[model samples]
Target: MQTQSVQKNNVHKKSRSSLSVYLGQWNAPVVGYVFIAPWLIGFLVLQLWPIIQSFYLSFTEYSLLDAPHWIGSANYENIAKDRLFFNSLKVTFTYVLASVPLKLAAALFIAILLNRSIRGISVYRTLIYLPSLIGGSMAVAVLWRNIFGTDGFINNLVVLFGFTPHNWIGMPETALSTLIILSAWQFGSSMIIFLAGLKQIPSELYEASSVDGAGPVRKFISVTLPMLSPVILFNLIMGIINSFQMFTQAFIVTEGKPYNSTEVYALFLYKKAFGSLEMGYASALAWILLIIIGIMTLLNFIASKYWVFYESESGASK
Candidate 1:
């Protein structure tokens, strides 16, 4: 009985020691995780859960009022057959292709100007960036509508310049273009990025080029473009992704009107989900958009190997 009692005590001591050591090993990390538990729970519950649920819903016919019926790939198949889907794709692609380059160009130009050490530069930058700060808001969309409508700012300007007054937003050909211009108008974020990129470039390169009898334009082409390529590539990918998801202005300013010339993909998905109560179809569209965005991002990454230049890599290669 004494031996048995000793054995029991030893076993209990070992178990306690093992548990204490284990707790000691993980104490800091466990506490750290405890502190972050709320964010983790929120991410899992709010963001990840919904994403996974949406993916599953894409495969099923789910109206909020009814049970989710297993429909397999019928939703995806319907997306292919739907005519408005095609129109949405066309309009979205047009907006992306048109807006991105113009926006980048405008941003780069503004960034170059802002990079200069001139008086009231901060105020000018703030004033210029003010449009982007208000961009995509309902107020901005309404203001944009007013600016391009018949008897609006554009028409009034045209009349003042001795040209016939015209409705910029009323015509199908020009409607999408007006939105593209609006997209370009919010070039502030891209401009800030370009400004940062410009600052990263060493002044010595400019000096070296100047010594080699290169003019400002030539220096910009040789020195600026190659160094700034990485920033440009980043901005391009982001712009493409953002442009694909455009909806607000299309909904507010045009409502996909003027012969459906501005029926963007996101607006179509939104209409499917809320407007038509076809949640399953909208989920399918969302999945399709994910695939498209994934493909575009993949393509950009693949193409980046050729165009995106890093100074460290270039220096090492040289």
Candidate 2:
């Protein structure tokens, strides 16, 4: 009887202890949530609400001055028929396609070079990264515009080389190309990511490749490429997304000038929203952009299975 009683008491104690531990764990999560409540609330109020409202507004005909009237896909239909819309879409797609690959390639190349053991390497990294921090700013956009202007740095360089100075910014053929170059100039962030990915690659693999009589190019192709595939994939996605959403530089620099040569989708949307006061149409455009980005991301994920490498997972398994 005494032994049974003692055992029961121990069981009761264990149950209480377990309950206390569970409560403690629960309290920590609650406290953490409480701490993060402000940010959560802000995201819901600012981002989530705006996204939901925009989706609803897309089906309507709304101007800021008046109540929205539901038009039932009229905005989407109009967008299909709109010449400017198609032009902007083409321009935006061109920009994204051209800029992202070039930019990423430049970044990866620079990253590989900088990954070597060199004196004051940190300074070189900082210098390269500085452009990314500044390139997206209004000031930098203005500077770019000036540099490409008729009487600007580029034209002056042409004059020095005994060539006739040409209008750079005012020319439709070259204006968009200038923007592409600008986009490529800000490759520092991608380079940093590539550097990080390079660091994660094991040095032993390189040694093994060397022992197998693999040259630099062969080693890069066989070992480095496979190991860095994941990072390459990441940079590709991010670069594509960012390029698709490019706005500030074009907005400040060209303002869709030279016969709409630089008129990207985002700028077109902005013009519709604020300039023409077509809120509903602008909202539809936003939704379309969101859908495009989603589709692209989905496609990338699907394609990644064939190329992207996981440390522990086989390609066939993926």
Please give the clash total of every predicted structure, in order: 0, 0
TM value for model 2? 0.89
How far is 73's C-alpha from truth in model 2 (Å)? 1.2
Residue ranges of candidate 2 with Cα displaced over 4 Å: 1-32, 315-318
Clashing pairs in 2: none
Q: Best candidate per TM-score, number?
A: 1
lDDT of 1 at 8: 100
TM-score per prediction, in order, is 0.91, 0.89
Model 1 lDDT per residue over 243-312, tens place = 9999999999999888889889999899899999899999999989999999999999999989788999
In model 1, the runs with Cα more than 4 Å from the true position are 1-23, 27-32
Each candidate: RMSD: 6.0, 5.7
